[model samples]
Target: MKPEAKNETQEMHRVEMTIGTILRWGVIVAAAIMIVGLLFYLVDGSLGVASNYHVQNFHQLLQGLIAGKPYAIMMVGIFALILTPVLRVVVSIYSFYREHDRLYVIITSLVLLILLTSFVLGIEFQL
Candidate 1:
């Protein structure tokens, strides 16, 4: 194979590996956070508190986190879990753009736009 083609292949492989590592670490970190939150809840004797707790927005979430609220910590973990794939999509868009693959870049961009729109609409309609 031409050296240029080989280098491109290696670059693509590296990108794929980086994406995989991001996904793996994202899940691991999220799970660890959730476990810590569960442990806090269990030890703090707040078993039923989460049932009544609702975080209204990022501000509230941050406040609760600062106050050492277990549910807030768990919510953060959940958010991280949800964002993992979205991050992957973002990375894929960058990877395709780097490779000059316009078709995939456009497709992934649309996917990201749809994801963001859904998030906006969901937040707007949320009670």
Candidate 2:
């Protein structure tokens, strides 16, 4: 009933709420990553066997990964696209740990990475 006690309770409640929010978003992100992985698997299957099978442009945006085509290089370069965001998240996680903050790090990193990646990759490289 004391003012100090009420403040403590409010602070604990806020921390709990923030933790719950982070957990929810983490789960959603994990699910999305899983779905995308599954799609990649399906696309891989459509690539077919290596010895005699062929994958046509009907299913491929570029000739094929091994064809050493420019589009293939570009497509492979897309993997590098993840570097900035991954680095940002790593830095933000350390920042959060040092600051004793919650997973706002993830949100902040995502936003920072998106803006940076858009400017660097989308505009500069046209990727």
Candidate 3:
């Protein structure tokens, strides 16, 4: 193996490590956010009422977040957890494209498309 090929391999490994670190930190941050929200809810004495499982609209959720609503913060944390995998897929798409891996780029693009389609449908159907 040539030194150039070894360097390329190292670069790919670094990219993979970076993506892995991003996912790990994403989950950690999301969990911390959720924990804080839970603590806030408990401290605020909102646990007595039954919490609805309805998904809040993004705009409303953002407003609630600005208003310091615990539930809204929790929902935002959930969204971050959900987005981690989508972010991974996007990163993979870019990596494959840079490597000129046509097949992988197409496959990863399809995965991304499906993920986005599901999110849109979920919002539209309120599911």
| TM per prediction | 0.93, 0.37, 0.90
Top candidate when judged by TM-score against the true structure: 1
Candidate 3 scores a C-alpha RMSD against the true structure in Å of 2.0
- Candidate 3 stretches greater than 4 Å from native: 47-53
Total clashing pairs for each candidate: 0, 0, 0
Best by lDDT: 1
lDDT of 3 by residue, 7-33 (tens): 879979987997898799899989998
- Model 2: per-residue Cα lDDT over 17-88, one tens digit each: 665555555555655544554465466554233555433332353544455433334343444444434544
Candidate 1 vs candidate 3: the lDDT winner is: 1
Alpha carbon deviation, residue 84, candidate 1 (Å)? 0.8
Stretches of candidate 1 exceeding 4 Å from the true structure: 47-50
What lDDT does candidate 3 reach at residue 99?
80
Go through the candidates in order and give each one's C-alpha lDDT. Answer: 0.90, 0.53, 0.85
The sequence of per-residue lDDT tens digits that candidate 1 reaches over residues 96-115 is: 99999999999999999999
Off by over 4 Å in 2: 46-127
Candidate 2 Cα lDDT to native: 0.53
Candidate 3 — worst ten consecutive residues by lDDT sum? 47-56
